[model samples]
Target: MKVLALLLASLAAVSAQTEPWCRCAAFVTYEHSEIMVFEAPEVTIDSCTDDAKQCKNSCTKELNDFSNNGNLWLVQENGLTVGQNICTYMADHFFYFIHNHRVYGYFEVCGGAWEYTGVASQQLLCCNGGKHEHCISK
Candidate 1:
């Protein structure tokens, strides 16, 4: 019985850590109006930061290649992660979030889409929980 208790406790801990740390959903408001969500498996705040950066890079590249659009990059001005009160901004398209995952039984999630706002000429189209197309405020 003690062994069983220990096993249960261990599982609880693992499940807790396996929560999602970052997420990006591709939304085609102009075309399909569907949102494709992606999220990384639960990890520590440090790993979450790294994964967030990687997802941003990969998703943006994929969208650019798929659409032949100009390069859309998320410059990680601040190395931030989950549990951090400050919202980390990326190339004005994506923002930082904590504890969100998509796809069941997956340890990682990543995707991309060519999302544009009418103001694309004036601002960068980006992801932040929701879509935000705007210039980085000075």
Candidate 2:
């Protein structure tokens, strides 16, 4: 019986694919550059309570620094006001999301690296970004 149970448990574990994607608590949009005819500028406010805001800014600057004045963006959200799931494969730079259970629809980062959790094996890691003072100001 013990052998059978162990085998079953191991099989279940193997069958489960741990897709560690960044889960956001609010809808987020990241624009790497200015869109033609789209005058709305990217978020310049550093109001994220976590590193999400800085991460977004880092990724944006990274892309823009190497591009030929072209714009790229990625939006991850369920609806107009709901959070969405994001993965590293969706863009060139790695991204992650932050959720503050203290409030509903509070903070979220669509595709950016705000802080490093210190765990080297984490899935959603910042490509070349780190912590920022403003990310924790609030």
Which candidate leads in TM-score? 1
* Candidate 1 Cα errors over 4 Å, as ranges: 1-8, 12-25, 30-34, 37-46, 70-138
- Compose the digit string of candidate 2's lDDT tens values, residues 1-138: 999999999999967834322322221223463111111123334433354655444434433332212211222243211112122321223333332211111222434433321111111212112211112222
Instruction: Output the lDDT of residue 71, model 2.
Output: 14
Worst 10 contiguous positions by lDDT, candidate 1:
98-107
User: Model 1, residue 11: what's the lDDT?
Assistant: 95
Candidate 1 lDDT, 1-138, residue by residue in tens: 999999999999978765334342333223343332332232333354346555445445443432233222333234322112112222223544312221111122322223232111112333345333333443
Query: Against the true structure, what is each candidate's TM-score?
Result: 0.29, 0.19
Model 2's lDDT to the true fold?
0.29
Could you tell me how far off, in angstroms, the CA of residue 101 lies in candidate 1 after the best superposition? 26
